[model samples]
Target chain A: MYRVKVYVTLKPSLLDAQGKVVKGAAVNLGYDEVENVRIGKFIELSINENTKDVNTAVEELCSKLLANTVIENYKYEIEKE
Target chain B: MYRVKVYVTLKPSLLDAQGKVVKGAAVNLGYDEVENVRIGKFIELSINENTKDVNTAVEELCSKLLANTVIENYKYEIEKE
Candidate 1:
């Protein structure tokens, strides 16, 4: 099996309200060092061994269903098991 | 600067509603090959250089602020920038 680890984050130009909320909470929780606490999405995919050309498969998946390319940016790592 | 990439995921015992929703959408979008789409949180922390022992710092931050240990499991990567 191949493990696909995907990290999806909003574009820098976009505002991250969720991250800001967490940052405020962190400050209340006494973690002053915390800054720019951006929250995004992480997805894990266990690609079937039969899938051909795993690289192409992941790229297609990311663009089509996994990520909304207009507002979010994504990059991934492929691991062999 | 230290780039700390943190991944927070729900434990196997927890229900992942967001993942289920995405999987259902994928099925409707004609991507039946997709299975077990687990969604989690991806956070990037730009650590200041003054922070000593980056490993310990990330561990503490992950437990205290980045993840909820009760239901989620977290891991991280630390890189120099």
Candidate 2:
């Protein structure tokens, strides 16, 4: 089996409202040193042995559905298990 | 400065409905070898220099807001920058 780890994060240019709230909460909680708090999605996909050309396949999958290219960026790593 | 990477995932006992949907979609797209897909959250907390006891601070943050211990498990690492 194989495990694919995908991390989807917002583009730097976009304003992260969720992150801003977290930062505010952090400061309220007395962690005044906290700065940027970026929230994103992490996805794990397990693939069995039958798949072929896994890299290209995953690339297509991510680009087609898992991530939005216009506002978010995604990076992935595959591990054999 | 420090960068903290946190990964929050559902407990093994919980049903990952979104993941299941993705797996079904993958199969429909001809990637029949795909098995399990687990969806989770990735958070980045950037901290500046004034904070003390960062490890404990992050743990507290994770427990209080970043993750729901009842159904989610979180692991984190800090990198000095």
- Top candidate on TM-score is 2
Backbone clashes for every candidate come to 0, 0
Per-residue lDDT of A33 in model 1: 62
Tell me the docking grade of candidate 1. medium
The digit string of per-residue lDDT tens for model 2 on A14-78 reads 99999999899989998888888999999999888567788987898888878899999999999
Q: Per-prediction DockQ, in order? A: 0.60, 0.82
Residue A21 error for model 2, in Å? 1.6
Question: TM-score of each candidate?
Answer: 0.85, 0.95
Q: In candidate 2, which residue ranges exceed 4 Å CA deviation?
A: none
Residue clash pairs of candidate 2: none
Please write out the lDDT profile of model 2 over residues B1-81, one tens digit for every residue: 899999999998999999999889888988787788899999999988567788999999999988999999999999998
Q: How accurate locally is residue B80 in candidate 2, as Cα lDDT from 0 to 100?
A: 91
Candidate that would win on lDDT = 2
